[model samples]
Target: MDLRIIWFWMVGILIIGYAILDGFDFGVGILSLFARDEKERRLHMNAIGPVWDGNEVWLLTGGGALFAAFPVVYAAVFSGFYIALMLLLAALIFRAVSFEFRGKVDSSVWRRVWDLAFGIGSLLPAVLFGVAIGNILHGVPIDASGTDVGSFLEMLNPFSIGVGVLSLVLFVMHGAIYLADKSEGDLQTRCRTRASQAWMLFVVLYIVMTIWSWIGSPFLFENSLQNPLFYILFVVLIGAIVFLPIVLKSGKMGRAFLISSLLIAAMLGEMALSLFPRLVPSSIDLSNSLTIYNASSTPLTLKTMLIIALIGIPCVIGYSVFIHYVFRGKIELTEESY
Candidate 1:
């Protein structure tokens, strides 16, 4: 296979890894805001405390891979989405800060303020990520030089916003299932109820976003329809969606969480299949699009990077597995707990 093609899929896998691992962390943070009391809120935070930062390693790795393998696309996207990315950065920073600072002070107001920060921080990224994907699918106004010339506000068009909401609902559902798995009694019941509610919303938004994407970005369907892998992923996505409710209803929280994670992976896989070689489609002119072929680094650079990635990615996987293994099972809040 071509090295560029290899790196393209490699980058896609890294992104999917990040989305699946850290997605529930965002969900848990958002759900923390709805906790009935301080203990419940701490439960939400502590559920993901150990693995959250480690899960984010996939994101950093994905970004580094993008920059290494597709410098032109990286440059174009980073420059175009500068302000939005800054907002995302700020949100993540605040969320991280809240984890530490919220526990330090005994004051209700201080903890409340940090709690709000954590919730908003999680909420913004959940929406923004979907919006970013929406814009990429809907196509951006990339000029001849391959830079996105569109204004920041243009990124928030109706279709993109709908996609953003869809993403938020999906994450909330994922988080609720995870929380349900990690709690017992009243909290678990509440988490299960939230998961079911979020599932309903996710279904509605999924249908709406599909229709909107069909209307706004018909080109995405063209390649996807022709690819056999798309059909396979589509089947898995639908199956996961269908079985999620059944598992949730049966109180199989772990299975429900697994189904939700599969749902996320399948959805992202569908997006990758639709995108194929195109990294950033140009609204101005399709010919100006940045594709895997057009935007990739030199062959030697790709080869060298592939060698490094081969050795490094497994280490990340091993560490992630080890951390999760150590932190597995229901959360038990102790004096040292977040």
Candidate 2:
């Protein structure tokens, strides 16, 4: 296989890993805002407290892989999304601070403030990430220099906003299922109810987004339709979407959570399939687009990184699995708990 193609899938795998992992973390934070009281809120926080930071490692690794494998795409995307990236960064920082500070002051007011920060932090990233993916799929205006020429406001068109909402709803649903699995009693019931509601909304928005994408970017579908893997992933996505509600109704929260994660992975997989070869499509001129062949680092560089990744990625996967196994169970709040 070509090194560029290999690196492309490697980058996609890291990103999908991040989305599946931290995605629920964001969802938990957003849902925590609706908790009935302080104990409930703390329960939400403690539910993810054990693993949230580690989840973010996937994002860091994804970005690093992109930078190393496709410097041109990294430079262009970061430069184009500078302000948006800054906002995301600030939100994540505040969210991290909220976990530690929310437990500190003992004052209800302070806790509330941090709680709000955490929710907003989670919310912004959920939406922003979707918007970014939407723009990439929809095509941005890039010049011959491989720089995105579109403004920030231009990035938030109707389609992009719809995708953002879809992302937000999906994450909320994912989070609710996870919370349900980790919680008990009234909170668990509420989480299940929210998950069902969010699933309905996700289905609606997903349909709308699909139509919008077809009308706006028909070219994205051309390659995917011919690819057999795309069909397989699409079937998995549809199956997950259909079975999630049934599983949730069966009082199988853990299975529902797994299905939700699969749904997310399949959705991203489809997106990646659609965008294969092209990392960032150029609306102004297809010739200006950054693609796997044109944007990737040299062959020797890719080979070096592949070797390094082979050694490193498995360690990450093993560590993540070990952490989840150690923390697997219902939430048990204590005086020492965040």
Candidate 3:
């Protein structure tokens, strides 16, 4: 296989893994904002407590994979999106600390403060991630030197913000499904209700975003449409999205959650297919855009990395699977719980 293509898919898998795993963690945190009381808040926190950190490792590995496999793209994205990435880092730090410190104090005020931090921390990253991807999909202002010529505020156009809102809704729904899966009693019922609401919101926003992308980001479909298989995938994507709510309403939390995860994977898959060859397209100079051929490492280097990945990735997957299997049940708050 062409290592560039292989690495591209590998990197995409790592990102999808992060989105599927930490996506729900971020979702849990976003949902935590709506908790009725400290008990409800703790239920939200503990829903993801066992797996959030482990989930983050996929992102770290994805970064490393990007840096190693596609150095030029890494340099361009990291430097061009420096401020955005830093904000994500800051939010992640604050969010992680909140998990530990929120339970340290029994005071309602202290818990409330951490709750606020946790919610904002989780929410910002989800919105910003979509905004960044929106910019990528919309094309960034990359000059000859591959610098983002656009100002920071310039990055926040209506389309990008709409994409951000779409992402937020998606995460909220994803988190709701997870909460429904991992919570109990009134909280579980409330989570299921929230999931249904989030799903309805997602359908509306998904339509709007689809219209926007069809108009503004038409390139995403142009190449993909050349292949008939893309249409099959789209059908599958729609089917999964449609089937999710039915399963949720049936009180099958595990099945609903599985469908949600698959739905996320399908969405990511579409993005990957649409974004193939070009990692980041440029608005200022199309020729300056980073592509797999222009942005990747040498073939020998890629082969070595693949060998390493073949060994390392399975270990990561095994470890992640093990963690989930160990924690596979509704959360019960104990002295040891978050």
Candidate 4:
């Protein structure tokens, strides 16, 4: 097997893992904004408190993998999406600060500002990430030399905006399901109702976005259509779609959330498969796109990095599981507890 191919899948897995774990952290933050009361908001916050910061490690790993395995693509993407990337970083910083310091202050007004900041901070990155991926799918308008020639404003269009909205809705729904699992009493019930209401919207948006991506995304559809393995991926995607409603209707929070996770993983996997070899698809032509083969570092570097990943990923997973198990109960805040 080609090492390039291996690195390609590894990067995809890293990103998907981040999305699955941290996506809920963002969702919980968004939920905090509209929660019934301060205690309810705090419950939402506490549900994710222990793991949210740690969840971001996957992103760092993914980025490092990209820089090590596909340096050219990383450089190009970072440059092309500089403004959006900066915005995401800012949001992350503010969210982290709000999470840490909101309770440190005594004034209600001061804490309220932090609360709102946390909500917006979390919300911005979640939506913008989807938009960034959407832009990738649609193919950024690069020049003849395969470089970014358009301004940031030029990147924002109907397709990318739609994807941003779709991602926000999906994650909010994901968080609601998680909240239902981790909370009790009024908050749990409310979260379930919210999840039920949001699930339909997510379904509609995902379907529409998928269709739009298929028909309108030159980079995604064109390449995938040419691949013989595309049919197999298509079948798996269809299966996930069919399985979703069944799982949701089953009303088992664990099973339903698991299904959601699977659906998201499958979708992201398909997207990666569709653009296989190409890390950043060029708007001009497929030939101009950044492929793993063209962008990869030396074999020595890749081997060393993979070795580190082999040792590191398991440890990370172990710690994550341990933390979840340790805190495995509904978040309740009594006067004394708070």
Order the candidate numbers by TM-score, best to worst. Answer: 2, 1, 3, 4
Looking at candidate 4, what is the lDDT of residue 172?
Answer: 87
lDDT of 1 at 256: 92
lDDT of 1 by residue, 180-223 (tens): 99999999998899999999999988988888888888888987
Q: In lDDT terms, how accurate is model 3? A: 0.88
- How much lDDT does each candidate structure score? 0.91, 0.93, 0.88, 0.82
Better of 1 and 4 by lDDT: 1
Pairs in clash, predicted candidate 4: none
Steric collisions counted per model: 0, 0, 0, 0
Model 4 residue 287 CA deviation (Å) reads: 2.3
Judged by lDDT against the true structure, how good is candidate 2? 0.93
Clashes of 2: 0
Better of 2 and 4 by TM-score: 2
User: Which residue pairs clash within candidate 2?
Assistant: none
* Residue 44 C-alpha lDDT in model 2: 94
The local distance difference test score of model 1 is 0.91
Q: What is the lDDT of residue 179 in candidate 2?
A: 95
